[model samples]
Target chain A: MATEQKDETVGTGTLGKTMAVLEAVALAERPMRFTDILAVSGQPRGTLHRQLTHLVQEGLLELRADHVYLPGLRLLKLASASWARNEFRAVAAPFLEALHAQTGETVHLGVLRGREIIYLDKVESRQAVRMNSQIGNASPVYCTGVGKAALSTLDDAALEVILSGIEFRRFTPQTLVDRAALLGELEAVRRSGVAFDREEHEPGIRCVAAPVCDAARSLVAGISVTGPAYRVEQEKLEAWVPLVRQAAGGIKNELDARLGPQR
Target chain B: MATEQKDETVGTGTLGKTMAVLEAVALAERPMRFTDILAVSGQPRGTLHRQLTHLVQEGLLELRADHVYLPGLRLLKLASASWARNEFRAVAAPFLEALHAQTGETVHLGVLRGREIIYLDKVESRQAVRMNSQIGNASPVYCTGVGKAALSTLDDAALEVILSGIEFRRFTPQTLVDRAALLGELEAVRRSGVAFDREEHEPGIRCVAAPVCDAARSLVAGISVTGPAYRVEQEKLEAWVPLVRQAAGGIKNELDARLGPQR
Candidate 1:
């Protein structure tokens, strides 16, 4: 977790320290016990206990009868407000729906966050066999279609910085195993205005993606149409390239209109 | 807002002060300015500013170019984890889907918190028109179907506390005007084993709801099938009462099986 470095950045303030403890619980793969959180947060047992108690009292964390801490319902209330207030997601909604209707596949909208991509919104396929992506989860930028497409929109210096920091852990045989391979693929993505994930991120999932840019041509986010590799044949995936690109362009156009040309 | 009372509960601790500011931003109807947050949090300018800066840096709050604060992307990540870790929501998912399919309407699963109901999950209808309720948003317990249904499961003393705290803010003409009216309905709800929202929370929105209880017969949550009044006739909505009740029962059964009979 990047939380170790994040802890250092926050320094010694009580608020920052408390937040670090909260993040430890929030980001855990499962509900954490007191000792588990203490290990991750590296805070004194007494301090961590007090922080956890305060968090529970504030409804920021829920301590179940099972003696494990989980994210509280209040987090959802706060997140609902966050999701509703996000102008980018609001502008992209209809476009996402349109794309989902046209493709009959899952559609994802994600933005670059450091070396990872944070999914902002998604439209699930009506079909039973759909991609199992959840909104707000982070994925590697070096292998995923949406991530690489977003990367292709960055200036060279920014791209280089991210690229240098990337630690490519191969998920599938087709995964680009190094920065050089990813750099080469990004060149093709920039030229074609799209990116492809040929089971690079997962064993059976593939997608066609394109970056959405603002009026200034700066990357705002990326959109993708993902499906099972067996069902989404190479020909069918290629056919979706233009459709995905158009949807990305459409979102950008709408955002530009809403925010004005000067923005 | 209940935040002022909540702030008092947290005392003058730095962490509490910081969270109060974060909550002020999180619970705002719109993005809040620094002054707006300061007014609500009742902190010194420098302390509030420092807290805001710290929160922004930690990704708990985001500052826009226009100098307004909104809940940050990190909140979504945390809330997503919280949602995934919620055993109640996980157990109810398939039942919710079945109810949505059976009724051809929006399905909501919510748990009572103080005087409100926090929606845990939703299965939206495939119709051209749908309910605007988001998964994480809270609705007043006395007014919403799910909320009232859950409230029916609470003991008289527990129920009285929530009823006394309610402000009875009327959103529509059909809303229960006071505690006595709501208590009368809760008594009826206990007998019938279901609750109805007849354009109570919002004009034209109606639902039939049932409470889900644990093996020990304590309230776990509530489930409801909601739709526009025009699209859902009174006869059709009444017909869904059994289906909604069955879904709630099924969710409770599954929870009992998964968490073990002792739980």
Candidate 2:
């Protein structure tokens, strides 16, 4: 399967179109009318109509009595199957729990999903803070602690590709908007084996994060312990450097045990 | 789009098969090697190989260095989008939170997905008890409180389709192993506008549940108040009936506000 011809496609040729319509619906953020879908899609009316009908039959989308559409539960169920089999999540959860328990702050485990850091898991502290992140939320790779930590391990060529498309929307005063400045920060993060976000993303929130790598020394994911700026000051943030790194190492070792010795 | 030709497919005409392969991989529960996938898929070697390669290229699957395959992050991203746009989860969470707070017990919000009930959200009590259900986890619809509540709202024909495939793996003596018995239970639930699980699914755990319907008077999801047998006894379970129904009504009203009036 790995070496199979890349362009050979099978079954109904409309799969890509079907999926595109689904993605459009997912992005729409509301139950969509047929006319609304027609506006989003490039497909001709007859073609789009057929695709929607088959999709409804396949349980990928639901049709309301008023003829609006929402995502069907089958998508959720399939996603759960993906989550259940993801080894990084299973391997890092206990260590994440321990780190959260030790610090009594929000802990996050994230993996690089293309140019963005996709949050795989999160443990919200009993004392909650106002944060936009949840388990599946995505954040830019140059700002947040976990994102920077994971980004630090990427080679120059890989980093260049990611840097090309980044929209450096100035999130806050502390956010790094320059690529050179970000690369410099990554260099420091690579040296120290940890990264810090001093309210770079959200005001009054800070975190220290470290990259989690496999036995091959390839970066896989990142973890962070985060708290409010008032509570987790510069000193407290620095203090988490060793703890976050240790937790990262602990996760790496567990991965190594399951995946064999380091290359 | 709904009235387009039933079988008119575009692109590669192989979308359904590709999705089926993806589903098989999802159900495999482990990173699967080529031969492993071959065993699961009915497609010949050439066809299956092409499908896998294309899927990997599409970012629906990831091929590991070990030559095994796992779900790629794109699936997770799409699922997150589905979850984000799901008004049901958003409308039901606060009510679930209040229910947990009021009853000091575990709260679950699930939706009917085919024959199974998919748990979309859960609010764990501060004083937690051992429980098998979690967010994204699923349970059978025949015996569980939330499951039965949602099932009772389905029309007889649709109900028959779901009931036809149910495997009565009795978890307890109270589990409904026969169709007639389950139908009788559903009839009672319809009359009372609620459902109860007297440790039918899991011994020492019981719950009272009610369906949440949309403004169109169609079943949307179900909510339940669950607790240990020692604390939430038969009498206590009965006491929760009104509370669950009230919360269910709250969710319905909130949904109605967003979705407009009954058709």
Candidate 3:
């Protein structure tokens, strides 16, 4: 059935408005009341009410008896499907496991998303005090090892665009505080084929990371071995560089074989 | 700014159509081509094209250069937000860990969604060989330990509604083959305050499960300790019932404290 066409200029059609409602609910840290969503969406009372009803019916959002909205289980099902079918993450999974086994540290597979990195997969360490980075959480591209490793593979112009957009919010004392400092570090990372987070993002966490590329040599993602700063000191991080690079190359080769030269 | 209202009768407004498109992509095990989605959606080419374009723009779907559509990273972001804020799952995590520690087995926390149980949280056993149940995967209520445990908690009328809908696809000889057989088992489960899966869902895998309830004593979810049947024999499964029941009760108490009687 051909649904009625919506005004192109107004909220980018029905699909756009629907996504806006979903995002409004998803982005909030807590359950949002109907009025709270109304304040954020600025939609008409009846229209917003209808949209909320539709969203709840579709399982994209759940409306509680208290009249608050939260992201629903359907999102998890969809995300699971997304995660399972993602070729890069699937190809990198065993490599992540192997790297984790070798280093006995938490392994992360993160993809560059604009000026941030979104973790796609994680193989957590068995250690009780390991760094707790949740999958799907976004971290600033300027500070994270995975972020900088991905940045190292980008062309100068693409890197410049990303750099220009980044606000160097100092996360820790060791975080690179200026564009010049980060660029200099990127130069080093490019030469070494690895990136290091020296308690740069979190106070007690550090990591060694390397970028994974496809057959076309385009950066697809980055893999990192992260741990508590005290355990993964500078010497240990340096020692694990070869292992990290090997895992990244292994993922790249598997991705290349699976994707067969991205068109 | 007020947007134009969509036809209420057609496609449940724009949100419904959008979710349809998303579900079409998500339900597919592989990346879907434009034609594949079009075929599945039965929407006009122009309408489907616009929905796909809008979905990609909103980061809810990614259209690869190869012209295949996949569920997007935005789904993961939304799912993660949903997962983090989920009160029942959050309250059950530490208890799941404790349960896993006590039994040295894989622990799963799953919630009843319709007639299926969707795993919300999982703590994998350290053993190299264990039952691989991914979080977010659904299992039939008639064949799985968690499913039967949840069914044990429901009143007869509610249980009948669910039981009537279930098609007893026998996964194994052990699976409950009909509603009468399942009801008989559920009667035993209710008396015991635990349920068992004796390789009913998947051969060589078994679990002992108990239903977690809210402050109102309403069934909220189920917690299970699953392992390979060869290792977790019937004797062990029988022995773990008390531990599983305790974990379930702990989760119920915590959830009660967190949500305060669920309004």
For candidate 1, write residues B1-263 as lDDT tens digits.
Answer: 34454344465366667777777798788778989887787777998888898888887887876687888788888787777667787778888888878987888888887678998888775523222237788889989999889888888788878777778888999999888899999999999999999999999999999998775543457999989999998899889888988888888878878768445
Per-candidate TM-scores read: 0.91, 0.87, 0.89
Off by over 4 Å in 2: A1-17, A29-41, A127-133, A217-219, A261-263, B1-13, B126-133, B215-218, B261-263
* Model 2: DockQ vs. true structure: 0.36
Please give the lDDT score at residue A203 for candidate 1: 96
Which scores better on DockQ, 2 or 3? 3
Predicted structure 1: lDDT: 0.81
| Model 3 bad stretches (over 4 Å) | A1-12, A127-133, A215-219, A261-263, B1-11, B127-133, B215-219, B261-263
Cα lDDT of model 2 by residue, A1-263, tens digit: 13232222234345555777877786586779999898767667998988888777666788877798888777777777787777888888888888987888888988887778888877765512211126667788888999899888877887888899787877889999999899899999999999999888988889999998764544467999989988988898788788899999999888888877433
List-wise, what DockQ does each model earn? 0.54, 0.36, 0.44
Q: If both were scored by DockQ, which would come out higher, candidate 1 or candidate 2?
A: 1
How far off is residue B261 in model 2, in Å?
A: 5.8
